[model samples]
Every structure is written in C-alpha cells, then in structure tokens.
Target: MQISYLQQWLTTPTYKIHRSQLRFWFSLSLTFSVIYSVLALELAFRGNYLIDSDARQHVFWMQRFLDPALFPNDLITDYHQSVAPSGYAALYWLIAQLGIPPLILNKLLPTLLGVITTSYCFATCLQLLPVPAAGFIASLVLNQTLWMRYDLVSGTPRAFIYPLFLAFLYYLLRRSLLPCLIALALQGLFYPQCVFISSGILVLQLWRWHKGRLCLSGNKQDYLFCVAGLGTAFLVMLPYALQSSEFGAVITAAQAKISPEFLPGGRTPFFHDNFLEFWFYGKRSSLVPRLSRITPLIYTGLFLPFLLWKSSQFPLARQVTPKVQVLIQGIIASLGMFVIAHVLLFQLHHPSRYTMHSLLVLLALAAGITLTVSLQALFNWAKCSPKSYPWKGYLARGTTVFLAIVLIIYPVFTPFPYAKYKQGKEPLLYEFFSQQPKHIMIASLSEEANNIPSFAQRSVLTSEMYTIPYHVEYYNQIRQRTIDLIRAQYSADLTLARNVIETYGADFWLLDRTAFTPEYIRGSNWLMQFSEARAVVTELEQGIIPALSGIMEQCSVLETEYLVVLPTDCILKFAQRKRN
Candidate 1:
C-alpha cells in the first residue's frame, strides 16, 4: 500500500463511513467479541460446573429458582438471595422458568451479554468519534479490560453494568429518549450504582457550555430528556429504598475502622495503612481501582486529556469527538458519588463500585483513541520526510508497526480470559457433600469451606473467602464462629469441641488433615483476625492436644490426604464411648 493511502485512512477515514468501511469495522469488533465469548464458554465448562468466585457469592442462591429444595435453611444462601436486586433476581427467575438450569443460564448469558456490551461500546465510541475504526478499537480494548476481571464472566448483577451503561450512553448521544429511559431503569434494576452515573450525564446535559461559561440549557427537549431519564431512575431505585434486608443495617466507616475484620489481613481488608491504597485504592474510598492488581493498560486512560490537548502535532487527533465531554461528566459524577459514599459509609455501598464500571469504559475508549492517534502521528511523520531521508521514513513506519502490534496484541497474551475467580476441582468431595440433607450445616476454617456452599449445596458456619464485612449482624456471627472454631480446635478438652458443634448446630465438621499444626492457625486469615485466636495458636505451638484432632480418625466418615469430614454426631458418640 502507498504511504499516501495509509495517511489518508489514518487522518480522515470518512465521517459517514462507506459501506465497505463499516463492514471492516464491524468485522474486527465481531471477531474480538466472538473470541471472548468462546473463551468464556470454555471456562464455564472447564471444571465440575465451575462458577466464578463472585458468582458463587451472588448467583448460587439462584439455583433455588430451579430446584426449590436446594440451599434450604442456609444462611449464606438466604442472605445473598435476600440482598440480590429485585430486577436481577426476577431476570434469572424468568430464565429459570424457561427450564434452563441456573448454571447453564449463567454460562450462556455472558456470551450474549459480551456481544451486547461490545456492540454498544462500539456504537457509543463511534457516536463520540464518528470514526468506525475508533469504535471498533474502543470495543476491542473494552473486551480485554472486562475479560481480565470476573464482571462479565460471572454474569452477576455487575455484569449488566457495562452493557446497560454503554447502551445508556449510546442512546443519550443519539438523543433517543425512550431507549435511554429503559437503559436507565435497567441500570437501576440490575446494577443500581450505574443509575447515579446515568443521572449525572442527564444532569450535565441540562447544563451547556456557551460563550466560555457553563450555562443551563434552555432547550425544552433537553429538559424533557433529563426529566424523563431522572424520573425513570427514581422509580427503579425507590423499591430498593423502601425495601429492607434481614441482614440488618449496612456497616458504617466508623464501625468498620474499629473492627478487626476491616483491618489489614481481615476478611474485607478495606482500610489500609498505606496512604495510596487507603485513599485512592481503598475499596470504599477509592476510584475504579479497588483491587490489589489490574491490567497496566488501565492507567493509560489517565493521560487521555493531555493527549487531546496536544492534538495539534498530529492531524489524526482531530477525530476524537467533542462528545468525550460526556465521559468527563461521568467521571465527575462518579467522583461526586464516591465522595458521598465515603461520607455516608456503607449506606451507598462500596465507593469503588460507583466509579469502577464508568472508569473502565472511559479508559478503554481513551486508550483506543490514544493508540490510534499515536500510530497515525508516527505514520504521518514517516511519509512527510520520505524523500529527505528515506531511512527516516522506514524507521518511523517500523516503530509504528512494532508499537501497534504491541498495543493490539498485548491483551491476548496476558492471561487466559476464562480462568476466572473460582473453579470446582474435587468432584468426589462435592458429590459427597451435595448428597447430605439440605438443612445440614458444615463448620470449618479450612479454605475448602469456601467451596462447599457453592458446590455442596450446604451452609458453612463461616468461610474465609466470602466474609465481606459490610453487614454488622452477618459479620458478627461469622466473627464469633471464627473465634469459637479456633478455640475449640486447639483445646485439649473434649467438652470444648462438643460445645462448638452444639452451639452452631453443625452437622459436619470439615477439617484439614493437618489442621492441628501451628502453621494452620498462623496462616489462617479468619482465625488470625481475632486476637483471641493468637493465644490458641500459641497453645497449639507448645503442642496442646486438640480434642477434635484425637477424634478425627474414629469419627471421620470420609478422609482424603488434604481433608477429613467428621460427622458431628459421630464425634459426640465417640466422646461418649470414651467416657464410658
């Protein structure tokens, strides 16, 4: 291809794309979506009915919709089901009514949602930039960002945030009021946090920048659009406001700061001593970055505005749409909500939730535009100096090709998109526990306890993985269980062990074969959260004979190298026989 042809495509690719151009853009976007969809399906079927970790916490209770007998009288199941959004639950209930299993639906939904999300992302970016290639590249970057996390693959309430939020943006840009309202309502129904973001945009649209000052729009349609959109948002959110969860009041920042469960190494581990993490990355106070790690490309979005300002160096920079202002409105609104969330503490939910989805969408678009502009700038420079120094042109074009490959190709090599948060490996263990009575409660501190509720259809007294300390009543109960389990496991007194089983009404006591060792307690995050457990650990280190350990071989109904399951009844019977 001639350098002039490449330059023309980079600089001005038709504002109203040619039929052929649209096909090329759609083809690239579709290819990326299909790759992600296939990977997600493969991951879904990779193990023994594997579910994402967050999905386990959110979607496991939905199985009851298909089989009413599942998770009967289970705290974790009941709590998650109770807290799940009315619309989210209803959507799955409707799917289950089609005779599809929840697991099957969960696996299948991501592929469709991924396509919908990508389509809207592409359209929204196109609406902003008008270049179909920009839209395609934006969606490509978005797919990469999403596949890195569990949001899309989990197919939980959070999964809808991307598609619904992007749909809202697309409709808003098109000034299509009815569809926008529906997207707004779905956002509230599905992911609630995103409704605030949509409302922010609506609110911003009512105010227009004119003559170098921000002035309220006098346009009647603007008022109507804002009114209709905000009204729909209010209607959807009102139900949640009126409803109450049996889990009790959400935990406050004051309460969380004082609790061990929110401290370092605690279950939620939100409050960090490190300043950067505590303020900017804290789950409750931070922005989109609440996690300990994320793809490095996410940071490129921070430099988007700077590049836009210096667009003069490259003519291709002119393609960035003025509608990029909408994303700025979203960030401003997200930040405002983030501040309010911190001020109100748990009343508004995690601060990170408010910003994460919006920021990711914005970042992906910005990164896409930035990469496009940077490559175009380099390519354009290469052609300009071809005659003066032919080597200069070759050098510039070679660098552009290398950089383009790295930007476009980097995401595929990072990690397997399908290897999500949780997967089931021990089929024998799952099958054995799943056969137990629905009302049976298993008690354990081992990490395996985390999998039982999802795989085995039983309640765990507590598990280290899912002890999100957002509710005082729930976390307190879990906290007490952690303390008692640790105390009972390390005590030489047989009565102490029996009391634990009686107090929790535990049907089975799942234990690691080497749970009595000093390392187990020291390594256990849940146990170490309580200062009381430290004394227990110290006693065990000095070789205290654990009453539970002595009875394991006699009472265990099943034993593996890694774990043993002791029936509480058998344990009590063994103690009685010994006493006799």
Candidate 2:
C-alpha cells in the first residue's frame, strides 16, 4: 500500500534521524546562546547588581552562603521573602565553593543557564517547525525581544525558566512524554511559576487525549504521568517551601507595626494621559515603555490585519485538528494568565514587566506567520516542478538563515545599551560607595541605597525597610517600637530626632536627592526638622532632578554639590546639640 504524504513525512526514518540536521541547528543555537551569555557575564561583573525591592531578597540569600547556618533551617528570609529557588541558588553555591566570588557568580551562572536555555529553545523550535531555518528564526526573534535585557543584565530567575519551559513544550508537542515530564519536574524545582504554566499545558494535553489525537495505551498511564510529574516536582520543591514558611511570621509582625496603606497599590490605571511623553519626549529613560502604551490602538490596528493576512496566505494556518487546536488554545490560555494577573493583581505601574510572556507569545505568532508567508512567496516565485519545489525543504532553509542573522547578530550590534539602561541608579550609587570606606550606617529614601552596604562594606538602610519589610520585618518591628518609645518621651522637637538617632544607632543620613526633595519633606514635620540639622556632605544629582522641581521644595539642602550626602560640620553640631 502506498503511504499518504502526511504519513510518509511523519513516519519516515530520514525524518526521525535528528542527528543529520543536529549540526546546523546546534551551531545556530550556540551562536545566539554565546551572545546572551557574554552579555550576562558583562553585566554581572562590570555592571552594578541591584533589582528593585523584590530582588534584594535574592542578594540576601547569596550573602548567606558565607555561613549556611545564617539562614535558619536553610531558608531564605528577606523582604517579600520566600523559599529560594533551588536551581539557581544551588548553582551559585557550587560556584561559590569553587572560589568564584558572589559578584562574578551572580553574573556567570545566570549567563550559563541562559545559554543552555536558549540552545534548548532552538532545539524545541526545530522540532515544531522541522525547518532548519525555523530554529534560527524563532531563536532570533526571541533573542531580539530583549530576553538578554532582563536575564543577562538583571539575572532574573524568570529568564532562566522561560527557555526551559519552551523546550518542555516542544518535547510535549513531539509526544516525548518522559522527557516532557522530566523537564516539567525540573522547572518546578527552579521556578514555581512554572507550575501555573505546566498546569495549562497538561490541560491541553488531556484535551488532545480526549479527542483521540494522543494515542496513549491507557488512561491509567496518562493519569500516572500527570501525578508523577506533579508529585516529583513538589518533592523537589519541598525544601524551599518549608524555608519560606518562616516568612509569614515576619510579614505578620511587620503589618502589625506599620499601616496597611503604606504598601504601594499593585494596581494602577492601565492607560495614563502622560503615555506619549515617554515614547516621544523621554526616549532615554531607564524604564522600558510598554509597547501597548507606545501605540495605544496598534494592537488592534496591526495585529488583526497581520494575523488575518498571514492566515489567508497559509492554508494550514487555520487550526484544524484537535491537537493543533489544543496547542492554539494553550497559547491563548497562557496569555490569559498574564492578562488576569495584570488586570487584577499587579499594580498597573508596571504592566509592561508583567506582560512580558504575553508579548513573547504575540511576537512568536508574528514570527511564525512572517516565515511561513515569506517562504511560500519564495516557492511560488521559483516555480520549480513538484519534485524540485520542496515546499518544506525551502522553508527549513530560509528560516534558518533569517533567524541566524536576526537573533544572534542583531542584539550584539544593536545600540540599545540595555544593560546600562537597566542598571538605573544602582550603578551610580555603587561607584560612590566604592570610593568610601566608612563603617557608618547610611539611610536613604531610595532602595538603591541598600546596595551601598555591598560596595562600601558598611551598614545601610532605606525606606524599603518599611515597604518590603520581608524577613527583616521581625527585626524592624522591634526597632520601630524602640523608636516610638524614644519619640513619645522626647516629643517632635530636635530632642526627638536626637533620641531616635541614638536609639537606632545610626551615624549617617544619606538622602536620595531625587526622591526626598524640599517639597516632599515639607509635608513631613519630622523630615523637615531632620534636614535642617543634617549638614550636606554631597548632593546626589541626576538629570531627572531638575524636572521634579514641584517635589523639590519639601527638601532642604544638607549638601551643596548634589553628589551624595555625608554629614558635614554644621549638621554634626546640630545633631550633637539635639543629643545634649
């Protein structure tokens, strides 16, 4: 019996032999992977390390490796504290054992994992499209979407998980159940967020099975696989889960001490009037403006038309079978996860960061359509006979070439300065801290100030203490109560300031010249008095300072230069008199 073309394509021994094509796919994968790794390493070593309030917890964990027992029961306890993800921590620990300093390992390990993840992402893309070019194209598109900007520079665990999750999905699509289960289980160990994504994929897989698209031997095996995958993942995660439990005590204590209103609302308006200002005027800002915001109606304008045009060009583009339909449904479901999180849970101030996965899905669909249409157009133009036309053959080749160039070369050469841009105020602070060797404690209004401890070999605190409160809340609660007692006894005069400073054992007050301006301080009776006495040692200046004049009047100058505030003679004399 003559085999149908689809059957021949699926069952042929030549198609099954991946090794024959492995060389090209591997080469393309490595090229882009190396570029991301290099970028990550550069950021880790050369760039200053700090990631808002949430990431400060990770830095705390890395610090604990100096004395494992320092973290009670081997748990990470920091602000927004949770059990540390074992995969990255374990890797960092091992590198630390090899005598690589935390500063270097922080960059090196994430870079290595990113490269591994990118390589696997390439492999997975190749399996789905089976065009040598598809692997290159998909990898390139993913690379171009600023994957390195976050993972390489910021060293986020989410970056490490993305490629791994993509690889697992690729294996799942190919019906490699065992490998898929293993990948899923491993992902659970590294990033628990993977569980939500894995659950979505399992639903899709079960739908495929129910529709008779997946020819499993029995329902029992399927059930066993699902249970085993989830069970194994949980087992691997047990240690970290237990470690995170202590954090509840910390949060509860912190909440009791501080006002609930003090926490920043995670939700904000999705659309703001000042949206065009960032896109058109402030092009050089560190915060990456959301694509949705930059072109408010573009999602509808471009996406709908392009999707329609691409679907028409490719006959198979319309999802037909139960399996293909399930896959499409899975992508939609993943995007829905992002949408719901942004709309309800996350503060609207950072919709762009949370919507990264959704953006990736959109770009992936765009890439797939672009390649399919471009190849089809080429095949028609060539007008070769059926045997020579090789529809699949041309697609595989063209996609590979396009991807190799776009993903690998474009990021390295692009003048975006993503690493520098994302570094924000932390790098500038690191430079200043490195120049000073004071053991004095420095307090600031900015979270970036916390990074000074790492650079200056001094103790530093920030308003982040009150905001995140994490594991430190337990300690801070005691400190706050002590401060309150000192304040009530002394009243709101200079006497209260002196008593609080002595009680807190603080030597230096490092104000954020950008955030704690004259206008903002005017509203606070305490800050107004505190600024009057503190002598300006340095004035930390940035370009944004001039534009924030409305907020500046609240602050009084302790320092004239606007570089950094160290206690000057006049300030020290005022503080001494208050103490007396």
What TM-score does each of the candidates earn?
0.92, 0.64
Off by over 4 Å in 1: 10-16, 282-284, 290-313, 316-321, 373-386, 391-396, 577-580
lDDT of 2 by residue, 1-580 (tens): 1123322222222245466555655586678657655654554456455333334445445655554433232211343224456676776677678777555555555556656656665665545444445455555565555443443344556555666677666676566778877787677666655655565656545444346466543555446656666676667656655664443443332342243222222111122235464222222211234332221211221242353446655433342122333335445555555554444432211223333443453345346434543444344343333656556555544554564355445545544325432233445555555454443545454444445544443455433332333344444553453334323222334444444446555555454554434344343332222323121111212222222222123333334334345442333455566568
List per-prediction Cα lDDT, in the order shown.
0.79, 0.46
How does candidate 1 score on lDDT?
A: 0.79
Per-residue CA lDDT of candidate 1, range 332-354, in tens? 88888888887887898888888
Error of 1 at 66 (Å): 1.8
In terms of TM-score, how similar is model 2 to the real structure? Answer: 0.64
Q: Which candidate is the best by TM-score?
A: 1
